[model samples]
Target: MKKIAILLALSVALSAPAWAATKAVTLSISGMTCGVCPITVRTALQRVPGVEKVGIDEAKKQVTITYDYSKTNVQALTRATKDAGYPSSIKQGERDHG
Candidate 1:
């Protein structure tokens, strides 16, 4: 009975959820020409699951997004922006940050 209980406890522990770390990435955006562009971009990024924060730089035409690594990725971030009418790519030389 003790052995069975130990095995059960071990199995439960192994099956527990693994929490993912937060990650951030910057993307170079295109087609943001007007004042409302940043708002649009922010909204798009925020709609993605796991997105925690979004910062937009209009003058630099870039956006930095923080998100949960398990729930999202750079591809999802770029896709969100593209769907919002402003396509984007990862900013050169900038890697995903935690």
Candidate 2:
């Protein structure tokens, strides 16, 4: 029973990170009509909990965000942008970033 308990504890510890993993993805944003638009979008994404990094491409109307999956998800991201008056969507087929 002691060995079994030890193995179970080890397994739980190893799997914890996977459960709260980080994910990065590119989001297509709309309503960015000028140079200052990226700043607004960036602020919106940054306010989300677990958001680590934000990269904005005004020309492409896209923003890439890295965040902890356990704290936030794509829905939260989109909602933040929308609430900030810039609606966004996840770009299809764009895999998670490093």
Candidate 3:
């Protein structure tokens, strides 16, 4: 009986749903000339409910955003960047910096 109870508890633990963390995407932005640009991008992305973190590389002109996909998507993120005065695009490959 003890062995059967242990097996049942183990099965219950294994079947429990795991909490998934947010996923990140990097976007290549254009026309960011100064410090304010990164702030603008961060602000816009933060408006999304599940956006956990944002990192901007001014030299590379890229924004790395970690967000919950269940709450937002790539299009939404790109739009946020555009609305912030720094238009952006998803980096597809090794492309020229803009």
Task: Give the top-scoring candidate (TM-score).
Answer: 1
Off by over 4 Å in 1: 1-19
lDDT digits (tens) for residues 1-98 of candidate 3: 99999999998888753444567888898787888888888999899777888888999888888887777887888888888777898876733221
As a whole number from 0 to 100, the lDDT of residue 31 in candidate 3 is 82
Flag clash pairs in model 2.
Answer: none
Displacement of residue 41 (Cα, Å) in model 3 is: 0.8
Per-residue lDDT of 11 in model 1:
88
Segments of candidate 3 deviating more than 4 angstroms = 1-18, 94-98
Candidate 2, residues 1-98, lDDT tens digits: the string is 99999999999999987677788989988688899889988988898998989999888899999999888888899999999899888887776664
- Candidate 1 residue lDDT tens string, 1-54: 999999999988887544458999999997888999999999999999999999
Would you list the rank order by lDDT, best first?
Answer: 1, 2, 3
Which residue pairs collide, candidate 3?
none
Q: Model 1 TM-score? A: 0.79
Q: What is the C-alpha lDDT of each candidate?
A: 0.92, 0.88, 0.80
How does candidate 3 fare on TM-score?
Answer: 0.72
> What TM-score, computed on C-alpha atoms, does each candidate reach?
0.79, 0.74, 0.72
lDDT for residue 42 in candidate 2, whole number 0-100: 92
